[model samples]
Target: MPFFVPVGRRLSAALGLCLALLCLPAFAIDAAPADADPAPIALDARRATISLDGRSQQLLDPTGALGIDDIAAGPPGLNWRLRGAGERTVLSGQTALWLRFDVLMRDTQAHWELELARSGTDAITMYYRDAQGQWRVQRAGDRLAVSDWANPDRYPVFSLDVRPDETVRYWVRVEHARVPFSGVFQLHDHNTLREQRIHQQFVLGAYFGMALLLTVVALANMAVFRDAAFATYAIYISLLGLSMAASLGVGGQFLWPNLVRWNQEAEFVLLPLMGLVGLMFVRQVAQPRRIGRTLDRLCLALAAAWLIGIVWDQSLPSALSLQALSALGTLSMLTIAAMLGLAWRSGETWIRWFAVSMVPVLLASTLPVLRNFNLLSSNFLSQYGIVIAASIEAPLLFYALLMRSRIQHETQARAHALERTEPLTGLTHRPHFLLRLHDSLVRAQRYGHHSALLLVHLHNHAEIAARHGREVADRALVIAASQLRAVARDVDTAARLDDDSFALLIEGPVKPDQVLHTATSLLANGLRLSPRLPAGTTLRLRVVAALLPDADSELAQDAAAHLEWMRQGMLTLSEEPRKAILRLNF
Candidate 1:
C-alpha cells in the first residue's frame, strides 16, 4: 500500500468514527430503566412546568382491558404501582396504561392549561373534576381529527379551573398498538401558554422559511445552470419543509385544514420522498465517478426501496410503514456517512465541505428516530430538532452548492477558451486569428486609421516535429510565440496562422520603415532555444510585412484586397527560399 493514498479515505474513516459516536445519544435512551421513576412534582408555583413520567402513579394492563374509571374505583386484587423515575417513560407492549397525578393550585386568579407535549399517541382520554365538582372528559390524540381538537393546538391542551387550596385528581388513560414514548407534561397559566405558542410559531416559521428559501435557490440554480443535481436538491428541501410543517401541526391547522388524512400521513409521505431525492442529490454533488460505481448503485437501490414504501403506503399498515421509516432513516444516515467517507478517500475535496454542512441536519434527523425507538427522551430537541437544524444547515448547504457550481463554471469556461486557442503556443488558432484579422481590417477601413500586418513563417516546424516528437516541437513553438509577444505592443494582435506560421497585427499608423524594422528584429531573434533542442535542429524564419494602400491606390479597395496582397507576397517569398524578409512599401 502507498504511504499517501487519497485524504478522502482517511477522512471517511474519521467521519465514520465521529458518526458512530453521534449515535451514542440514541443508544443511551435504551439504558433508561423500565422501572426508573422521577420524584413527585410539587405544585410549588402558581404557574409551573413538570414531567409526569415517574412523578405520577401508573398501572399497566397488557390486555388493555382496564380503563381510567376501573383504575380509580380500586380493583380489590388488581396491581397498582408508582411509575419509576426516568428521563422519559416507555410503556412497552400492547397495553393500556393509566397515569394519575394530583395538582394543588394556590392562586385563585390563575387559570391553568395542562398540555401533553407528546405527539403520535394512538389515543389518550383524560378524566378530571372541574370547579363545579362535575366530572369532565376530554379526548385528544392521533385518533381524533385536528379540526375536532378541543383547543385547536397541535398537542392536547386541557383547561383547568382549580380553586385555591383545593387539590384536584387527574387520570389519563393511554392506549397504543406499539411501544409508547412519553413526553414532559406541562401545567402553566394562560400567559405562559401564549408565550410558548408564540415561541413555537417563531421557530416553525424560521425553519419552514429557511427550507423554502433553499428550495427556491435550488430551483433557480437548476433553471439557470441546467444542473440536474439542483433540481433533486430542490425537491429534497421541499420535502423537508413539508415534513417540518406537518410534524409541527402548522400545516394541518393552516395549509390544509380540510385534508385530515394528509396531515396524519404527512410524515410518512414526506420522509420517503426526502430520502429518495436526498440520495440523488448526494450522489450528484459527491461526484459518483470518484465515489465508485458500486456505492453509487447501492444508493440508488436504497432510494428506490424508499420510493416503493411510499407508493405502497396505502396498502400497508401504518405501523409497518412507520417501522420501515425508522429502519430506512437509520440506513440512510449510515449510507450517507459511508459514501461521504468514500468520497473523501477518493480525493473529492468538495465532499469535505458538504460533510461539514450535513453534520447538524444529520444529528437533527437521527434524534427523532432515536426518540421513536425509545433510545432518546422525547423533548423539544428530539421532536423539533429537524427544524432547528434545518434553520442552521440550510444556508450552509446552499453555500456548498454555490461553491461547487462556481468550480464547475470555471472548468467549463477554461475548456471553452481552449477550443479557440492553440494548445502548443497559447495563442488563438488559425481560424480564430483569421476572423480577428478580418475584423481588424474592416474596422481600420471604416475608421480611416492606418494599420500594419507582420507575418512570420517558421519553415522548419515539420522537420523538428518528425525528428524530436511532438513534445519537443510543442516546446519550440511556445518559445517562438513568447519571442513574438515580447516585441509586440499591448494593442497588437499575435496569433498562430497554421502549423508553423504566425502573424501580428499592429493597430496604429506605423511607417513602412517601421514595419521593415519590426520584421528585421524578429529575424535577428532567430526562433532558437538553448537546453533541450536536438543538436542540429534549427528553424528558418520567413517574414512578410505590408502597409494597406488607400481605396484609390493600385491595390484592391477593400480590406480583403490588402490581405490578398500580403498572402501573394508571402507565396512569392516562399518560392524564392533565399529571401529572409519581404517589406511591401505602399
Candidate 2:
C-alpha cells in the first residue's frame, strides 16, 4: 500500500496481459512426427511438444465403437477433427481425444520420459506395444486415485525405450468432465526430468512457505487483539494456500496421497470458503457504519449465500456446481471491490491499503475464471497464477493487517490508561494502586528486592473545610499531593488511596532510616498551600513509613497488615507534640 503508484502500474500491466490472453482463441496444434515414407526426425533429451492435428488425432466415442486394432492399423478415412489451429485445443463433453505421434530415438541407450504438464484433466492413458508385441497401457490423472498412478509423481509421466532410427507410434487418450480439457505434452530424459521436478517443487514450496508465514502472523494478531478480522484473514489465507496446493498437485503428492477423494474435492471446497472468509474480512475492516446498513446487509447475505452454496455445490451436478462456484467467486470479487471503492470515497485509509494489497489476487483470478468456463486455454499463468499472486499478496496484506492491529492496540492502551487514572489528582486511583502494590510485593518477594510503603493522612483537612470552605480544603489537598509528588523518587508510584489519604510504593534498597527521613520531609512540606491563606490559617499532616520484607518471609504474606499498624501508630502519636512521622518496620 505504501508505494501504491508503482504497484498499481505493475498490476495494470499484468491485468493487460491477462486480458490479452483472454481475448485470444485456443488453437489446434500439429505435434505428430512425419509419416513412415518420410525421413525420421530424431529427438534427444531436450523437451519437445507432440503436436496433434485433424489428421494425427481422432476423437473416439465413449461407447468404444472403434477398437484398438482400428486405431493401431492407421486405417484411412478416419473421422478425425481439429478444435482450432495451433498447439493448444479446448474440447468439451464425454469423448476422449486420442493423440497419435511417432517418437524417433537418436540415442537408444537413453530412456525418454513423457510428461503431461497440464493438471485438472480427468484421465489420461498412454498405449504402446511391448517387446512381445502386446499393447500395454499406463494410466494417470485426477479422475483416478493417487495410488492408481504408475508412478507417485505430481504429474502423469511415462517412460519409453526405443532403438536408434526406429520410429514407434504412441497413442495417448485424454478425457475430462465439464471443464475444457487440453493436454500439453513434453518429452524429457532422466536428467532433464529430474531438474524439472526439482524446479517445480522449489516454486511451489516457496509459495506454500510464504502462505504459512502469513497465516501464523494473522493468527497471532487475532490472539493478541481478540478481533474477528484477523481470524477471518487467517482462514482466507489458509484456504488460498490449500487451494493452490491442490491445484498445483502438491496436496495429492504429499499432504493426502491416500485420501484420493479429498484430493479431488479440495479445490471445489476451498474456493468457495476463500470467497466467504475474504468477504467477511472485508466487512470487518470496512466498518458497517462506513458502508451503511443496506450494503452491509448485502455483504452478510452474500456470505450466508456462499456458506449455503458450499454445501449445495458438493451435492449438485459437477458442471452446474463448477459454474455456480465460478459465478460466486467472480461476484464476491466485484462486490468487495465496490465496497472498497465506497470506503475509499468515504476517506478510509486502511480500506485503501487493503485494496492496494488485493491487486495481485484480483489480477491473478481473471484467467482462471476464463479458463474454467472454456473461454481461454490453460497455460502457465492460468494454472499457477493464483499461487504466484498469493506469494506477493499475502505479505502485502500482512503489512496492512499489522498497521491495523497497531492502531487498535494503541487505542485500547489509551482507553485503559484513562480508566486507571484518578481525574482529581492526575495519579493512579485506589483500585489500580492496589493492583500495582500487589504486583510490586510479588516481585519483591520473588527477587529479594527491598520495598517500602508510605501512607500520609491529612489530619487538619476536615477542620480546614469547616473553618474556610470545602473548596479551600480541596486546594490544600491538591497542594499536599504536589509536595508528595515532588519528594517521591522516579521509581516510586504515588497514588490517591482516599479523599484525604495518599500512598507511595517505593521499590528500594533504602534503609529504614532513609524512609523515615522522606516521610518527615513530606509532612513538613504539607503546610505549603497554593493561594496566600488568611492570616492565622494553618494545616497539619501525619505521615507513616513501613519497610517491607526483602524476601519471601512471613511479613510478605501480610503486606497489608503494616498499613493498619502504621495508621494506629499515627493515631497514638496524634496527641504528642511534634510527632509528625511514625515508622513501622517489618
Candidate 1: tens digits of C-alpha lDDT, residues 362-475: 667776566556566666776777777777777778877777777888888778888887777778776676666677766766777777888788877788888889888887
Give a tens-digit lDDT track for model 2, residues 1-586. 6855443344455666766766576433344533332323467644343333322444555544555677778688555443232344444455666766667887666677778786656678888886678898888887677778876688888887576777777777777766766546767776677887899899888888878887887888899888778888988889888888787778888888788668777777877787788788877887655647877888888888887788887777467777777777777766666666566665556656777788778767776667667666666777888877777777677777778778888888877877887767667887777777777777776877668888888888898888889888887777777777888889888888788888887876667777877887886676644354555665678877776663433545454564565567777767776787776654
Specify the poorest-scoring 10-residue window by lDDT in model 1.
31-40
Question: Distance (Å) between predicted and true CA of 380, model 1?
Answer: 3.9
Error of 2 at 300 (Å): 2.6
What do the candidate models score in CA lDDT, each in turn? 0.71, 0.72
Candidate 2 TM-score, true structure as reference: 0.72
For model 2, what is the alpha-carbon lDDT of residue 536? 63
Which runs in model 1 stand beyond 4 Å of their true positions? 1-47, 61-80, 84-95, 145-147, 175-179, 287-293, 388-396, 439-473, 479-494, 504-564, 567-586
Number of clashing pairs per prediction, in order: 10, 8
